[model samples]
Target: MKGFIEDTNYSIGLLDDTATPRDVIDNYIYEHTLMGKNAFFVADLGKIVKKHFKWKNIMGRVNPFYTVRCNSSPAVLEILAALSMGFACANKNEMSLVYDLGIPMENAVYTNPCKQASQIKHAAKIGVNLMTCDSETELKKIARNHFNAKLLLHIATEGISGEEDMNMTFGTTLKNCRHLLECAKELSVEVVGVKFHVSSSNNPQTYIHALSDARCVFDMAEELGFKMNILDIGGISENEAQLEELYQAVSPLLDVYFPEGSGTRIIAEPGSFYVSSAFTLAVNVMAKNVIEHDQHLPSAGKQISNKPAFIYCMNEGVYGSFARKLSEKLNTAPEVHKKYKDDEPLFASSLLGPSYDELDVIVEHCLLPELEVGDWVVFENMGCGSLNEQSPFADFEKPSLYNFMSFSDWYEIQDTGNTSESLMKSLCVPCFHLGEDQFCTV
Candidate 1:
C-alpha cells in the first residue's frame, strides 16, 4: 500500500493496521521529552476525510465552504481542496493560498463583510467575483474596486436569549438590506444572495425567523430585478444529532422558500466541524508552583483542612495555541501524559502560559495529579482556532505539526477516485517517520 503528502518537506506516516493515533502520540511525546520537549500537534488527516463523508451523508444539500481563518495549515487546505470542497477566504493571504492550490476561482467566495480596498482589488485581479457586502460603504467600495463583482448581501440575525450576542453585530438589518440592494442596483453590481450567521446555541425558532427574513429580502430583491440564487448559512453544528435536528428545522423552510425546482444554492461555513477533532496538541510543563491554602468548612464546626493548590505553567498558552480562549470559552481539559494510579490523590491545579502576563492563564481551575517540570500534557479537539495564532509577544514558537493517516484511510481515498496525482503522488513506507527534524519510533 502507498500513501502520500503534498509537501515533500513533510511526509505522511502511513500507519500499519494495528497502529493507532495514540501510539503515534506516545512515540512523539517520548521522543520530544527526551530531546527538547517542545510542544507539538499530531494530526490525523484521515479523520478529515471521514468528516467530509459524514457531511455529505447528513447535510448533502448544503455545500461546505471550508472557512480558512479557522485553521490555515497547508496540509489541511490541500486535503480539503483535494476533496473538491469550496473555500471561504477572509483575506488576501487565504485567497492566495487557495488559488495556489489550483482550486477553481468559482469555488472560492470572499466572505469578509468588511474588506480592505486593496484586497478587494486583489480578488478582482485574481478573477474572484463573488464577495460579501453588508453596507453601502462596502458595496460602493467594491463597485469602485471591482467593476464585475457579484455580491452576497449579509443580513444580521437576532441572538437567542441567554446566548452570546455576537450575532447582533455584522450584517445589515432587513430594512437596511433594501437600501443596500438599491445602492447595488445603482452601482451596476449584481446582488446574488443573502448571508447570515447563526451559532449552535441558537434556538430552532431562530432559523425559522432568519429564513423568513431571507425570503423577505429575496422578494424585495426580485421586485428590484436582482437575481438571488445563493443562501450562505454562516456556521455549522459540531454535533451530528444537533446537525440533524437543525436540518429538520431548516430543510422544510428551504422547501417552502426555495423549492426543489429553485436554482438557489445553499452553502455553509464549516471550519471547526471538519478539523477540530482531527488534531491533538501536546504541551510540556515548563514550571510548577504549589501554594498551601487552608479550606475552611463551616459545616465541620469551623474546621480547616490544609492542602496544596498547584499552579502549573506550560510551554504554550493563550498567547499561542489557546489564543481563541481570549474571546471564546474552552471546556476541553488536558489529560496528564504521565501515568498515575486511579486512586492517586488529585490537587486543585491551574494551568498558565509561559508568559508572565496575568491574562495568559489557560485553565483557571482543574483537578490534576501532581506533576513536575518537563512532564507532558495532551489536549484533544484542538484543531480549530489554534494553529493560526499571530502572537505579538516575543519568543513564541508555534507547535510543530506531525501529519499521518492509517493505511486503510489512504486506500479509502484511493478507492473514491476523488484526488489527483499532484495531491498525493509519492509514498512513504514507514508508519512513524514524518521528516528529518521529527521522526517517531513505535
Candidate 2:
C-alpha cells in the first residue's frame, strides 16, 4: 500500500481547479503588491509566534522562557512580551531586545554564561537579575563586575563538547561547583540553580536524561550544603506530540525530584518548538528554466539516459532566511502540492533558492508537487523552525508570504505586475488585516 502522501492528488483533495497550493498559501498568508514587484504579504512573523505561545505546551507549570536567538524579529519579540512569556536571552543585545519592548527584566533570564563587560553591565543596569555561570571564573567575573547578581549554573551536555570541552569549561565539575558554592557563600553571590540543554535531538528521552542529570547536579549542590531555587531543564524540541511524551517522562521526574513544595521550579527554554511550523516561506521559483543534459554515467554520454535538470532559484538564500545546510535532516524541502495547471507533473523533488552562495538553497533536495515559471514555491522553513538558530540565519532575517492564488482579498492591491521594484512598496512588505476580508500594507 502507498503512503497517504504517496497516493494521487486525491489524497489532499482539491476544491476547485483554481484551488492550487499557491491558492492555499494565498489564503493563509497576506500579501501586498508593489508597483513592479509583488510584495506577497509574506508573514506576520508576530502572529505566528503568539499562536504558538498559546499552545501552553510548556505546561506553564515550568517557567517557559522564549529563546531569542530563534527568530529575534522585533515582530516576534513584541508579541512574546504581550503574551507575557519570559525570555531566555543569550547576550546583551538579546536582553536589550526585550527591554526595548518594555518587558521588565523580571520576565527574562540570561542564559549565555560567558560575556563581555558590556553584557555584564547591561544585565546589572536592567536588573534582569538572573543569569548563568559554567565555571568558577565566570562566577568570579559576575561577582566582581557588578552588584549581587543571581545566576544558574550552565552545566555541559554529556559527551557533547569534546575535552577542553565546555562541559568542564562552562559548568564547574560537581567537585568544582562545591568550590564555586564555597566562593559564592563567601562573596554573597547567588547561585539560583542548574541549567542544561538536551539539544542533541528532538528526543523526549533526552529531556528525561537531562532532568535526571540536573537532579544529580542538584544533589551535588545540596551535598555541598548549597540550596537551589530553580532547575533549568534546559530545552528540547517540544512539539505537541513530543511535548506530551516529555510531559509523561518529565512530570514524574519532577514529582520524584522537585516535589512541588520542595523549593525548586522547572524552567524550559524553547524557541524553535514555539515558533517552528507556525508559518511558511513562500517564494516564486522566479523561473523554471532547464538545462538539457545527457547522463554522465561511468558509461559516458553515449546512449543518453537524458534528463532535465529542474534547477530552481529564489530571492531568499543562506543570507536571506534559508538554513538549508544546517538542517540536513529538518531542512525545508519544497513540494508542489497543487499546481495552476493539470498538465504539470503532480509531484516532484525540487531544490530551491539561488545557489550562488554556499547552500544558499532552501532544500538541497525535495519532493515537490509540480513546477512552472513564476510559480510561487512555498518552503516550510519560514515562521518558526529549529533550523533558523544554526548560524548566519540567526542574523536579521525576513520571511514573507506571497498570496499568488487563493485568499484573493487579503491584499492591499488585487493585482500584481512584474513592473514593481519592491514587493511591498505601498505599505512596506507584510500588511495587517484591517477587515474580515481585506488587509492594509505594512
Candidate 3:
C-alpha cells in the first residue's frame, strides 16, 4: 500500500520536473491540445469496451448487454452492437440509440419499469422483444401499445440508490406477481422471465441478493403457471468480487427451474462494469485559485479558516464522469491511482475536481500528497469513469470527433482517427507549456 499511496508532499511536480499523476500529465496534453483553453471531457467510450468484453468469457452463459442509460455515445453504441451484444434501454431516446446501433430487435430489452405511451410505442415500432413493468398500469400500457411485448416485472434491490429503486417504483409482490403473470397469460404476452438489479451500489451480496431476487421471481413465475424461459439480471458480472457468489446461488436454479423445453436464457446487462476504467478523461487546467474566508473570534483573539483553500478548476466538473460526486454509493469509496515525485512524503488534506464548491470536494481530511494546478486525476477501480450522465456540455458544440486543438499549431499530429486509444496517446503527450516546449518535457 505504501507503494500505492501518494501521501501529501506539497511541491506539485510540473512537466519536465517530476512525475505527477498519470491523469495530471493527461490533463496537460489535453489542455495543450485545446490550445490551453481548458477542455472539458466527453467520455472515452472505447476504452472500457475493449478491455472488459472478452468474447469467450462473455459468450458461454448469461449474455451481456450494454445499459443505454450509461454513456451512450454514437461511436460507443456502434462498437457495442458490432460486438453482437444486446442493449437495455430505459426510454425512447435510449431505445432509438440502440436501434441506431443496429442491434437485433430481439437483442434489445426495455428495462425501465415506468414509461410514457410514446416510449412503449417506439419500442413496439422497433419490435422490442422484451420489456419490464412493475405496476398494473405499466402492464396495461404495454398491452395497449406493444401487444407483442413480453415484460419482466422489476423488483427492488432494496436500499439501492436514486434511479435504481425498482422496488420503490416497480415490481409486484408474490400476490401481485401472480396477478401480473395472469395478466400476461390473458393477453398472450409472454411473462417468460423476470429481472432485478443487483444492488450494484452495495458490496458483497448486492449481486448475490439480486441473484436471489431473480430466483424468487422465477419461482413466482413458475407458480403462476407461466412457463418462462429467460432471466434478466440487470447489471454486470464483474468489478465487484461477488460474481462467484451470484453464479453459485443462481446456477443450480438453471436446471431446477428451466427444464429443456422450459426455454429460459440468462441475460446480464452492464453499464459501468463494461466501460469504466477503459479510459482516462482528458481535461485541462481551466483556472486555479485558493479561496479565503477567516473566522475571527474577537474577544478570544483566535482566527481559523474552516474550509481548506487548496482548490482546482478543471474543464470537467460534476457533470462528466465524476457526476457520481453526489451519489453515496459512488462517493462512499473513491479510488485514486497515484503517481508520486519523491519517495519520502508528508500527508496533507487532499481534494480534487474542477470546482471550488463545498460539496464538489473529492477527498477531505485524507492523508494524501498535495497536488496543484495542471495536475491530472483518475480513479482506481473505476466502476463509472468520468463521463457522468449530468456532466455539462460545451457552451458551444463538441470538438469534431477527435479534432481537439493543441496549444501550439506547430506540433504535428498524425491522424489516428477518433479512437479512445489514440485520444489517450494524444492526452499522454506533454504539449502544453506557457514556456517553450524545448524547455519542458514530461
Question: 275, model 1: CA deviation in Å?
Answer: 0.8
Per-candidate total of colliding backbone pairs: 0, 23, 19
Per-residue error for 317 in candidate 1, Å, reads 0.7
| Cα-based lDDT for every prediction | 0.82, 0.57, 0.54
TM-score rank order: 1, 2, 3
The sequence of per-residue lDDT tens digits that candidate 2 reaches over residues 252-271 is: 87888889889787788877
Model 3 lDDT per residue over 175-269, tens place: 46667777777776778777766554434345455556667777877786766677776776454444555555565655565444556787878
Candidate 2 least-lDDT 10 residues: 1-10
Best by TM-score: 1
Compute each candidate's TM-score over C-alphas: 0.90, 0.72, 0.68
Between candidates 1 and 3, name the one with more favorable lDDT.
Answer: 1
lDDT, ranked from best to worst: 1, 2, 3
lDDT at residue 168 of model 2 (Cα atoms): 49
Error of 2 at 188 (Å): 2.8
Off by over 4 Å in 1: 1-9, 160-168, 295-306, 390-396, 420-422, 425-429, 433-442
Q: What is the C-alpha RMSD of each candidate to the true structure, in Å?
A: 4.2, 10.7, 10.3
